[model samples]
Target chain A: GSSRPMKQTKESPNVGDVMSRDVVTVFEDIPVEKAAKLIISGSFDHLPVVSRDGRLIGIITAWDISKAVASGKPSRIAEIMTRRVHSVRLDEPIELAARTLDTHSISALPVVDREHKVIGMITSNHLSRLLARRR
Target chain B: GSSRPMKQTKESPNVGDVMSRDVVTVFEDIPVEKAAKLIISGSFDHLPVVSRDGRLIGIITAWDISKAVASGKPSRIAEIMTRRVHSVRLDEPIELAARTLDTHSISALPVVDREHKVIGMITSNHLSRLLARRR
Candidate 1:
């Protein structure tokens, strides 16, 4: 008699399982200086820029702040923030998130909902931790 | 009769295997502005600060530059760089690198030699790529 194949015990986690739920976001109207302070104080390198209705608009990073300092322009987040943001949904596979990050050369991605509101954030730091645990 | 156990086909790679060998370093005496330019022009967020004799002295990140811009002080790299930098050895395991990065809340570590000179650099980006491949 043939035996059934063993059920797989380990399944790949989704982005929601690894992402940080309590994301710190900044409004587009805020000064870049304030956003810089938030990034400096927090452990995160990127922050999602939100609209008045709490929708994801853009993303700001330490690099943007450095650029502002270097060029002495764009005092507001709306000016220096990267308008073309890449994001992932909660139910997406971790591999997809990893691929997106690697392809875009970005460190983090904001997790958005159906309404395009930022719900969480994931970064390479999270992937590093996951790899450490697996090892 | 007894049988020997099967040998493991896969082993964890070392820091040397994944690290970027061509590291970009900056001198300690250069202006923070110069370092900021290098960071902007390059794809790296951190730059190792080297002595005149090519010894690793400190490390500077985009966060440091943001701090300088926010505070409007410390124009030179020596003043703004983090003196207490954590590094890794080439022959060490990748898990150790991950743990060091996680423990210290740093994104990258400079790989050093027996003489404490920078030889390579590794970051979370590399680890992310590794994880992606394993999946």
Candidate 2:
């Protein structure tokens, strides 16, 4: 009895639609102190760690930098970066991104392309903005 | 005419309804190094800095810790804490909280009482979770 089309009702936005395109990444070989400076200088909390080929190899967060400072850990990003990085594809559903973040207890995820290169970044901040607009 | 009452249609949640009540606060005089440790040990990024009488004075965030480490700043919390803090009331609507966050470009807000004491905390994470549930 509804007038809305099925396509209109089922059009869920993909991660690419909401993810931030201006992603700032750090090289894995960079010093932790430098990484700390980069994170502190920016408004964001997470930075994707990249390889020489510009592929996302890991992630370093403000929490990781705090841990480094708190414990006086090693100097290089390789020593403190989370190597087991979780990411999503550009075409993935937003719900899947939300579930992935909830399951891993992370605030952000790197959106990779077919070549496994970082194309964008998505975070709970983006989701919050989406929700705010919905209202 | 619809049978639904106006109250039923207009019932909106407040900041107190969704904020995290188990807030962890730090005294203003505590060493910044200790606050860094506290933030590293917990899953939170922001800590409400309070006075001796437990009134919310300012906030120290992981970003602040990173800045301290990067710039080799002073040791005390009061020297580096964000003194001009923005807060929300318990009974305020969630839209107001969202607007405040958007306007200030801050991720979290401390939910305060009539005495200006922090009773709970709300962040973008809470808003993201609310959105996830709505889906």
Best by DockQ: 2
Cα lDDT of model 1 by residue, A1-135, tens digit = 113211111466889999999999999989877887888888578999999898999999988887786676587889999999999999998888888888988889999999999999999888887756654
lDDT of 1: 0.84
Candidate 2, what DockQ? Answer: 0.40
Question: Deviation in angstroms for A70 in model 2?
Answer: 1.1
Over B24-85, each residue of candidate 2 has an lDDT whose tens digit, in order, gives: 99998888878889987778889999888788999999888878877876779899899899
In candidate 2 chain B, where is summed lDDT lowest over 10 consecutive residues?
B1-10
- Report the poorest 10 consecutive residues by lDDT, candidate 1 chain B: B1-10
Among all windows of 10 consecutive residues in model 2 chain A, the one with the lowest summed lDDT is: A1-10
Looking at candidate 1, what is the lDDT of residue B17?
Answer: 95
Question: lDDT of each structure?
Answer: 0.84, 0.82
Q: Could you tell me how far off, in angstroms, the CA of residue B24 lies in candidate 1 after the best superposition? A: 1.0
Clashing pairs in 1: none
